[model samples]
Target chain A: MRTIRFLLQKEFRQIFRNRAILLLIGVMPVMQLLILPLAANYEVKNINLSVVDHDRSAYAQKLITKVTASGYFKLRGYSASFKEELRKIESDESDLILEIPQGFERNLIREDQQQLFIAVNAINGVKANLGGAYLTSIIRNFNEEIRIELLPPGRFNPAPVIEITASNWYNPLMEYRFYMVPGILAILVTMIGGFLSALNIVKEKEFGTIEQINVTPIKKHHFILGKLIPFWVLGNVVFSLGLLVAWLIYGIIPVGSLLVLYCFLSVYLLAILGFGLLISTFCDTQQQAMFIMFFFMMVFILMGGLFTSIDSMPDWAKLVSRFNPVSYLIEVMRMVILKGSGWKEIWPQFGIIALFAVFLNTYAIINYKKTS
Target chain B: MENLYAIELRNITKTYGREKQVAVDAVSFHVNKGELFGLIGPDGAGKTSIFRILTTLLLAEQGEAWVEGLEVKKDYREIRKIVGYMPGKFSLYPDLTVAENLDFFATVFDTTVAENYELIKEIYVQIEPFKTRRAGKLSGGMKQKLALCCALIHKPRVLFLDEPTTGVDPVSRKEFWEMLKKLKMQGISIIVSTPYMDEASLCDRIALIQHGRILSVDTPENMTGNYPGQLYAVKADQMYLLLKSLRKYPEVLDCYAFGAHAHVSFKNAFEAAPLKAYLRGEGLSEIEMKPIPASIEDYFIKLLKT
Candidate 1:
């Protein structure tokens, strides 16, 4: 224990003394939390739409106004020629084109329906699909308005109409940042914990200081524990800072017990830091460790269900994400913060992370040899 | 049986790589209780390999080693407690202050600098002024001094220094030797390795090693005193031609440049008059030749040839 204390003291002293890394520790989480959530927004806006109105009627003009007023589309061009709008979609000036066929307000009243055409660019699939969906819904609302006006003034037209009501719970406004904050916070904490611990031992190896330590009476586990503790503390500090940023910048507060968040956080840090140590044991230099950590970090972040839902992934990918520690932490963060869940809700994830922590740390300890 | 030697290695062999290069092969040596022993060899003579095996940082494939009577393999935990090791490279944490590095190692051994200050004082006081400076900021000699101080902080029964003076300045090298001599007086058995042949004479005993083998192990004085051939230091204005002429002589067994003179060894005896007369016949003047004692380097050169 005394040896571990000294080791921690030395390790912490080194970590804080490096001004560049100190700057990194202070600024990286603040910058990532504040910047990434706003930039990684899932709700796509500013889609370009071109409208070609050939009808030149009162309702056709209203349809154009309704599409622009929905705020999902930007009316880049409004023209009476279909050739001009087709050129707009072809030149990538517009994501979609809504064309109303040549008719008076006559067709809907006389034949009960009229044909409208929506040609989407479909080059950028998400933006195109979302733009098409928004235009379709707005036209459906317009159709309802026309049908109501044409109805014979409470003459009891017998048509079965279903009225659907939707209310957004948890995030009533459905602010994208609120969903993103905790997930991004989980990732930022994961990066700091994983990279720092991975570099700790390998830096000693590069500097040839491990040879000096190997000859000492310090137990292998004591040395490993020393490495684990200082970085664990740093991970916690970054996590807390991220939380503060979340609450301050995005106005997000965890509705669940703070104890549950911290409990999972402490265990998550252990599992990720253990994984870093395991990599540290396998590498001989900081560069090797960094590359290995980067490769794993890439895999962890992509498959971690932050940007994409785990359930939406293919069967093989979902099976693979089951082993990613970051995914569980992200789930736990969302469950506890958004759902106001307590220990009862997060216990299963907690058990998996604790198991990961024990297995990785034990393997690293056994793999670390004082003698070759 | 009670172990008589402070350290021992018997028929130790270590091989590396897929091609299996032998680093230390069937090598055996010992050190006395308080003697300052030297492993005198050049850079790749397997000196560092031997230190690693005994320090429990590496394993020898074929044989056995014991430190303070404990097997290096079985009793490594106890052995680590009783030995201090300074590797060929400077291994202290560069970002940590000198004081921190020393204190860290001291704490690691479950001791304090004050407990072993006497063992390292002769070297420590010189570097104490810069204790707050990071170790990487120190000069080469100062870094070496700091490394030595850290290694000695635990007051081990035995200290292993592998080529401690390889890159140090000459004056600092002398001072380092002086420090080692003082530590010997404090009853700490020291086994230091060096490539400098001149430094070999300063140790109580040294094992001359080459190519993963020990050529000889004995007191420096006795090793030179038992010279088997007549050696001479020959000087000439045309030194290169003198070397060729000397090697051409059938009676000359060995001839090579050594400092300002060409050293030529003879099988049985050396007479300067015959060599001088021969040099004159070969159209050389101002030739000087005289019999001199062989040095550890000469002995090593002769061993390599045989």
Candidate 2:
């Protein structure tokens, strides 16, 4: 225990001494939480659109008015020809283009056939698909209105249509902030625990002091435990600060007991820190340790379910996500915050986190060599 | 009866990897209690490997070793308790303050600065003003002093220093040796490794190692005395041309550029005066030639020859 205390004290002293590292570990999360949600939203709004109405008829104008009124698409420019409007969109001046064919009203009323064209840039395929779907739905709804107007005035007709109700369970609006803030907090905590501790051990190796420690009477368990404690505490502190920002800015709060959340976070932090120590054992230089860690973090954050739902991913990707501790923590955080879940609802996630903590720490201890 | 030896290595050999490259060969030597022992060799000569093995940071295969009467393999845990090791590189945590580094290392051995205050007081007092200073921010000399302090905090029975004076300025190197001498008086057996041949004189005895093998172990005075051959330093106005022309003589055995003079050895039957005349005939002026005492480098070169 004394050895653990000494190692922890040494780690804290070292962390406090490096100003750049302290800023990275402490202030980075808060800044990310405050500014990132504003830019990360997925809901497409106010999409600038261009129109080329070869037929300047009343019917064509009505379609334009309907699209503009829906708020998803705004008419930013009107071109005389299809080529001119295509040029605008190609130059990134507009996101979508609408073309109304010539004699469209004559065809629709006399011949009973009408056609229009909608073109959307597919560079960001998701946004383009959503925009295309939304425009098509508006056009279909307008056509149905005309059909309703044409129905017999005296005859009473009633037909049954199935309704989905389309209710979103925990987050009614699926607001991006509610999903992102908690996950981002999880990433920040994991980084503080893993990256910081890995750098600490590598720094000692570079400085030659680790060699000195090897020739001492200090026990190995004490040394390893000591190195982990400071980062573990610091990880929790950052986690809470992030929680505070989530509450104040996004009104996100846990319905579950604070104790349970901290307990799980602590175990998860231990697993991350142990993984860092294992990485440290394999690296002889700080730059090497940092590079390897950056690679692992990339994998974790991408597979961590921060941006995409794990359930929606392919089977192989979902299986990979099961091994990701950050994914579980994010799930638990969302459950507690949005679902107000307790131990029974989140126990599976907690068990996996505990297993990760024990497994990674044991791996670190076993791999660490007393001699080089 | 105990042999009064501070360290004893019996056929110590260390092999690394599957193919087994011998870093330290079947080498054996001992340091008398309170004596300053030097391991002299160039890079890749396995000096650092030997020191690391003695310090308990590595295990040497194929032999037995003892430090302060404890076997290295069986008693490494106890060996760690009684040794102060300063590795070849400056390994102290650069982020921690000087005081913090000292305290951290002292705490590791379950000892306090006050407990061994007398042991490190002289060295610590020099850098005491910089106690709050971060170790990385200090000068090379100050860093070495702090490293020494951390190593000595536990008041170990022996000190293992691997090239501690390398890359240090000449003046600091002298000061460091002086500090080592003072510690030696307090009966701390010190084993230091260096490639500097000049430092051999500072040790009570030195083992000249090459290619992981011990060439010779003796006092510096006797090693120089044992150098076989007559050596002469010769200089001319045009020294470069003179060296080229002089080596052409069949009587010359070896001619190497020593500072300000070329140390030339002769064939067994060669005469110095005739050689001097031969050089004078070659139109070299301001010629000065004289026999001089052999240096450690000369001794080592002779050993290599044999």
Candidate 3:
């Protein structure tokens, strides 16, 4: 414990002394919380749309009016030919295009069926799929209105009937802040473990003070544990500070136990620190450590189920996320803060994190050596 | 009085890598208690490797070492408590203030600065003006003093410094050795390693190491005294050509340039006046010839040649 205190003091002194590290730890969280949410949104708005009209009839005009009235698509431009419209789609100047066939009013009256063409960009597979679905729904509503208005006496039942209402939960308003803040919190908390610990050991290696520690009476585990405590405590402080800001700036209140969130956070922090210590043992330079940390940071954050729902991922991808500690922590944070979950509800996730903590820490301690 | 032997090694050998590059061969030497011992060698002579093994930071592949009567491997923890190690480079928390660094090291050994306050007071007082300054911000000499103070904070029975004055100015190097002398007076066993030949005289005994092997181990005075050949200092108007010309002489055993003069040894008994006359005949003018006492460097070169 004395060794731990010594190492803790050493690490804290280093972190506090480096202004750049301090800024990364304290100010970065708020900046990410504010900027990333506004920029990284799943619900795409302000979609630009182009229209090509061949019939130029009242029916085609009414169809365009209905598409514009729905407010899902903004008519940004009008094209004279299908060539021009297709060119617009190819160039990505517009997200979607609407086309009306010639004699559309005559066809609807004579054959009781008319075809409307819609083209959309599919690069962002999810957004494209959603846009296609929304466009179909708008056309379906217009067809139903035409049926009720044009054919009053005849009971043909031409307009196919099916109703589906989409609902969003947790963040029913679909605010990006609600989706992003918890995930960024998880990332920052884990970074505290990996980056700080790796840098600390690498700094010692550079300064040659590691030999001083090695020649001391302190056991290897004592030395490692001492280094872990200060960063662990600092991670928690940052976690709590993030929570405080969420409440004060955005009025986000936890629906679950803060203690459970902290417990999972602590376990995740240890696992990250253990992984970092393991990294430090293998790396000899601070530049190498930073590069390794950057690689792992990219993997963990991307796999944390932050941008896309883990449930929506394929089975293999979802299965892979189980190995990512950040994935478990994100779920635990959301469960505790959003669902107000208790120990019984989150015990399984907490167990995985505990195992990760124990496994990584054991691996780190076993692999770590006092000397090169 | 305490036992004369402060440290002992038996066939200590350490090999690095899976391929086993021998860093320290089957080498053995000991330093008496309170003796200022130096392991003098050039770079890559395995001086730091030896210290690492003795301090228990690294374990040798073969052989044994003991410090203060405790086996290095078996009693490593106890040895750690009784040894102070300052590596070849400045190895302190650069971000921490000088005082914070001192306090941290002292705390690691379960000791307080106040307890060893008297021991480190001399070194620490010099760096006290920069107590609040970060260690990285201090000058090289200041950093050197701070490292020494931290090393002595635990007041260990033995001090292991690995080329502690390598890059410092010459005056600071002189001052550092003077500080080591004061600590020696206080009964600390010191083992310092250096490549500086001038520092050999500062130690009671030194082992000249090369290529993971010991060339010689004796008192500086004794090592210089045992030069096998009669060496003469020779210089002429063209010293380079003079050295080259002397090397071609059948009577000359070894002729190597040292500073402004050439240290020439003869194959058999020869006189200095004849060598001067011989040089004059070989287009040399204003020759200076004299026999002088051998220095440690001369002995080192002779040892290398033999």
Candidate 4:
């Protein structure tokens, strides 16, 4: 234990002595926390729509008014022809074009049906799909209203309809930032903890200091602990700073106990830092360690359900995410901060992370050979 | 009997890579307690490999070794506690200040600088004025002192310094040897390696090695004294030509250029007048020849030749 204390002292001194590293540790998370959430939003708004109404009937005008009033789109002005609308789309002025053919109202009354055409620009797929869906729903509602107006009150007709109402439980407004802040916080902490500790031992190897340390009587476990603790502490500091940034910028306060959040953070850091040390033990140079860490970080973050829901991923991806420690931490962060979850609710995630902490740290220590 | 020797190796052999390049061949030697031993050889002589194996930083493929009577492989943990190793490279933390590096090493051995101040005082005082300076910024000589200070902070029973003066200035190299002598006086066993043959004379005993093999092991005096034939320092006008002529001479056994003179040995003792006259007849002018005592370098070159 005394040996570990000295080692920790040395590690911390080296970390603080490097001015560039100090600035990076203090500033990187704050910038990422502030900027990444703003750009990560998936809500598609401000779609531009153009209409070509050849019928010039009341029905066509009403449809146009309704589409514009739904607030999902902005009218770019009526085009004279379908060719003109296509030109508008080609010029990047419109994302969708609705055309009401000639005699459309006459056909609806005489033949009891009419066809309308929609040309959607599929360039931005998400925006195009969501816009098309929103327009379909609005037109469906307009059709129901027209049917109600056309039927006489005395003529009785009965049709059953089912209404579904959705209420987002944790985030009532469905703000993406609320979900994103915690997830991003998880990634940031993992990065700081993982990369720093991964580089630590490799740096020693490059500098030839490992020879000096290996010759010492210090226990392997003691050396691993010394490496793990400093970075773990730094990871927590980054976590807290991210939380503060979340609270200050987005006004996101955890509904669950702060004690629970810190509890999970502490254990999560152990798992991540242990994994870092594991990489360090396997690599002989800082460059190799950095590349390996980068590869794993990309895999862990992209598949960790930070931006996309793990439930929606393919079977293999979801299975792989199950093995990612970052995924577990992201789940715990969302559950506790957004759902006000208690220990009983988060115990499984905590258990897995605790297991990772034990497994990875033990593996790292065992792999760190004193004699070679 | 166990405590009499500070280090012992028996037929230690180490090879590296798929081709099995032999780094340290079947070699063995021992250093007595409180003695200053040197492994004198040029680069790639496997000096660092031997030091690493003895310090428990490496494993010998085939050998049995002991430090202070404790088996190297089995008793590495206990050995680590009593052994201090300064590797061939300057391995201290570069960003860390000198004082911090010392404090860290001291604390790592479960001791404090204050507790073992006397052990490193002579070396530490030289760099103490720049205690706050980062180790990387220190001069090569200062860096050597700081490394030595860190190595001795624990007051180990045995200290292993591998090429500690390889790149250092001569003045600092002299000071480093003086410090080693002082450490030896306090009953610490010191084993230092160097490529500089002049440094060999400073050791109580040395093993001259080449190509991963031990050529000779003896006290410097005895090693030099064991030179078989009479030796001469011969200098003449056009020294390069004189060296070639001496090698072709019938009586000449060995001829090597040793800084401004050709160190020549003869197969049999002969009068200087004949050699001097013979060199002049070979179209050499201002020929001078004198019998001189063989130095460690002379003995080393002789051993390497055989």
Candidate 5:
């Protein structure tokens, strides 16, 4: 314990002594949190639509008005020819084209049926899908209105309409930042903790100081704990700072117990730091450690359900996320910060992360041998 | 019997990587209690490899080593407790201040600097004024002094220094040897390695190593005293022509350039007068020739060739 105290003291002195690293630790997360959520907005809007009206009918004008009025799309151009409007799609001036067939109103009244065509640019698949879904729903609503106007008053309809009124639980306002802030806090802590500790031991290797430490009588675990504790403490400081940023910028406070939140963070920091140390032991230089950490951070964050929901992933990808410690933190952050979840709600995830901490730390210590 | 040998290695060999390059080959040597021993060789001669094996930072593939009577492979933990190793590289945390570096190392071995202050006081006092300065900001000599102080902070029974004077200035190197002598007087057996042959003379005994093998292990005086040749230092105005003529001389056994002079080792029948006369006859002016005792460098070169 005394040895750990001294090691902690030394580590802190080195950390504070490096001015560039100090600024990086202080500035990086705040910048990322403030900028990424605002730009990474998932709600798609302002899709450009072009219309080719061969009929020039009143109903065709009404349809265009209704599509523009829905607030999901902007009518970019109108042309008499289909090819001209297709040219609009090719030039990147518009994302979709709607064509009204000739005699469309005569066909709807005489034959009680009509055909409309929508050509969607599928380059940005999410935007294209949402735009197509919105246009289809609008047309369905228009068809229902025309059917109601044509129905005889005495002739009763037998079919029932099922409607769904979605009430977004936990985040009633559905503010993307409210959902993103907690997850972003998870990423913030993971990155600062992982990158710092990942570079720590490998820096010693590059400087050749580990050779000095390895020759000493210090126990292997004691030395690893010495490396672990300082980062764990720093991880907490960064976590608290992130929490303060979240509360100040987004007006978000955890609905769960603060003690429970801290409890999870403490264990999560250990797991992540252990992972960093594990990466360091496998690498011989800071450059190698940085690249390897970057690769893993990429994998962890992308699959961590931070940007994409894990539930929607294929079986293999979902299996991969099961091993990602970052996912659990993102999940626990949402559960605690947004859902008002207590200890009972997060116990399973808590147990899994605790296991991760133990497994990773023990493996790291065992892999770090003083003697070749 | 075990107490007499501070460190011992026998038939130790190490091979590196898939290239199968030999680092230390079947090498054997020992350091006596309180003796200042040096492994004298040029770079890539496996001096650092030997030190690493003895320090337990590396494993010897074929031989056994012991430090303070504890086996290296089996009792490494015990060996680590009893020995102090300073690698060729400056291994202290550069961002850390001098005092912090020393104190951190002191704490690592579970002993405070106060407990071993008397042992390092002689060297530490020289660097004391800069205790608050970061280690990387220190001069090369000062960095070496601080490294030595940190290595000695734990007061181990044996010390392994790998080229402690390689880049240090001459005056600092002399002071460093003086410090080693004082530590030897305090009964700490030292095993120091150096590529500089001049530094070999200060060690109580040295093992001249080359190509992962030990060539000779003896006192510096005896190693030079036992040099087998009639040695002569020959200098002339036309040094290159003189060198060409000396190599072709009948009795000239081996000759090589040594600084500004051609150091030639001749057979027993060879004489200084004949070489001097031969140089003059070859149109070389202002020729100088004299027999001088072989230094460790001369012996090291001879050993490397033969």
Candidate 6:
């Protein structure tokens, strides 16, 4: 315990003395939290649309007006021919183009049906797909209106239909920011905890101080704890700062108990810090340690289900994500903050994190060699 | 089961890399309690390797070592408590002030600065004026003093200092040796290594090592006293040419350039007149010659030749 106190004192002094790193730790995460959620939105809006109306009939004009008025697209311009509309798409001026054949109103009254063509730019697959779906729904609504007008109101009655009213739970309006803020907060904590402690011992090795420390009477467990606790504390400090930013900038206060969130954070930080120390023990230089940490953080963040739902991933990816510690924290954060889950609801996740804390830390302690 | 020595090593060998480069060969030596022993060698002479083994910072692949009557491999925990090590480089926390480094090391050994003040007082007082300065900002000499102070704060039974005075100035080097003398009086056994040949005389005994092997081990007096032949110092107007001429002489057993003069040893004792005649015949002028006592450096060169 006494040895750990001295080691902690030295570590804290070194950390605070480096003003540039202190600023990076304090400001970078908050900035990322405030700006990233706004940019990482999945809601596609304001799609650019173009029309090549060859018909010039009342029904075609009405359809064009209805598509523009649906609020899912912006009209680039009206082209006289399909070739001109293709030119608009090639020039990057439009994302979707609609064409209506000539005699559309006569054909709709005489044969009771007509077909329209939609040429969607498939370069950005998601945008094109969603845009096409929105335009189809609008056209369907217009067709239903036409049918109702031609039926003379009460003369013919349609078959019975069931109305489906859908509601989004947890995020009533489906605000992407609410779902993203908690996940981003988890990433921030992981970055601070993992990178800093990962470089701790390797920095000592570079400076030649590890030789002095290794020759001392300090126990391996004592040294490991000394390294783990400081970064663990700093990780929590970053977590709290992120939470404050979430509340102040996005108005996202956790709906669950604050105690429960903190409880999970404390254990999660330990597992991550231990993993960092484990890397430090294996690497001989600071550069090696930094690169290795970068590799793992990249894997953990992309597969951790922060931006995408894990359920939508392939079977193999889902199985791989089960091993990522960040995945568990993201799940816990979203569950507690978005769903307002209780201890009983999150106990299983808590158990896995607690196991990681024990296993990773023990591995680090056992692998840390006093004599080589 | 008698433990008369503070440290002992038996046939210690260590190799590194896939090619198995031999760093320290099958070497063995011992230091008695409170004795000042020196390992004198140049940079790659394996002095650091031996110190690391005894200090429990490295493992020897083929041998055994004991510190303070405890095996270095098995009793490391107990050994660490009683031994202090100062590596060749200044390894203290550079961002930390001198006082903080000292306090930290002292606390790590479960003692306070005040408790062992007397042991490090003579050395600490010199750097105490700049106690608040970061260790990295101190001069080379002051850094050495601060490192010594940190090592001595625990009052260990044995202290290992590896090349403690290699880069220090002359005055600081003198002061460091004086401080080591004081620590010796306190009954603390000290083992120090240095590449500086002059520092070997300050030790009670030294092991002259080269190429990872012990060439000779003895007191400074005995090592120099055992020179096999008479030595002569010869200098002339053209020193480089004089050295070549001396090496070409049929009677000269060995010849090496030492500073301003060429130290020449002969197969047998001969008068300086014939040597001077030979040099003058080679167009040398203003030649001066004398017989000087062999120093540790002379003995080292002589051992290397064999």
TM-score of every candidate: 0.94, 0.94, 0.94, 0.91, 0.95, 0.95
Query: Alpha carbon lDDT of residue B70, candidate 5?
Result: 89
Q: What is the lDDT of residue A70 in candidate 1?
A: 90
Off by over 4 Å in 6: A56-58, A81-93, A99-110, A120-125, A149-151, A154-163
Tens-place lDDT digits, model 1, residues A1-372: 788889889988998899987877889899988899999987879999898888889888988899899988899988899899999888889888888888846797799889899999988988888888888999999988887788877854587767898898988888888888999999999999999989989998999999999999899899999999998899989989999998888888899999889989999999999999999999999999999999999999999999999999999999999999999999999999998999888899999999999999999999998888
lDDT of 4 at B81: 92
Off by over 4 Å in 1: A52-60, A78-92, A99-112, A150-157, B236-246, B267-287
Per-residue lDDT of candidate 6, residues A87-183 (tens digit): 9999989999998888888898789899888999999988999999999989989998888877787865678867779999999999999999999
Worst 10 residues of 2 chain A by lDDT: A155-164
Q: Which sections of candidate 4 miss by over 4 Å? A: A48-112, A116-125, A138-158, B232-253, B266-292
Candidate 4 clashing pairs, residues 3+ apart or interchain: none
Error of 1 at A341 (Å): 0.5
lDDT of 5 at A273: 98
Shift in Å, residue B85, candidate 1: 0.6
Candidate 5, pairs of clashing residues: none
For every prediction, compared with the true complex, DockQ reads 0.86, 0.78, 0.74, 0.74, 0.87, 0.81
Give the per-residue lDDT of model 5 (tens digit) for A1-372.
898888888888888988887777788778888888887787778999999998889888888899999999999999889898889889999999999999988898788899999999999899899999999999988887777777776663667768789999889988999889889889989998999889999999999999999998888898899899988988888788888888888889888888999999999999999999999998999999999999999999999999999999999999999999999999999999988899999999999999999999999999997878
User: Candidate 3 on B1-306: residue-level lDDT in tens?
Assistant: 234578888789988999999999999999999999999999999999999999998989899888998888888888999999998888887878998989998998899999999888888888998899989899999998998988899999999999998999999999899999999999999999999999999999999998888889999999989988678888888988898889888899998999999998888997777777778888999888888888888899988888
Give, for candidate 1 chain B, the lowest lDDT window spanning 10 residues.
Answer: B266-275
- Worst ten in a row by lDDT for model 5 chain B: B267-276
Model 1's lDDT to the true fold? Answer: 0.91
lDDT of 2 by residue, B1-306 (tens): 254688998888988899998889999999999989999989999999898888878888878788998888788998999999998888888878899889888888888888998989999999999999988899999999998999899998899998999999999999999999999998899999999999989999999999888999999999988877778899888878788878898899888778889888887865767887888888887888888889878888778777
Docking class of 6: high
Interface RMSD of 3: 1.5
lDDT of 4 at A365: 94
lDDT for each residue of candidate 5 in B1-306, tens digit (9 for 90 to 100): 265599888899999999989989899988889999999988999998888888899998999888888888888998888888888999999999999899999998999999999999988898999999999999999999999988888889999999999888899999989999999998999999999888889999999998899999999999999999768888888778988998888888888888888899877666667767877888899888788889999998898787
Instruction: Tell me each candidate's RMSD, in Å, in order.
Output: 2.5, 2.4, 2.4, 3.2, 2.0, 2.2
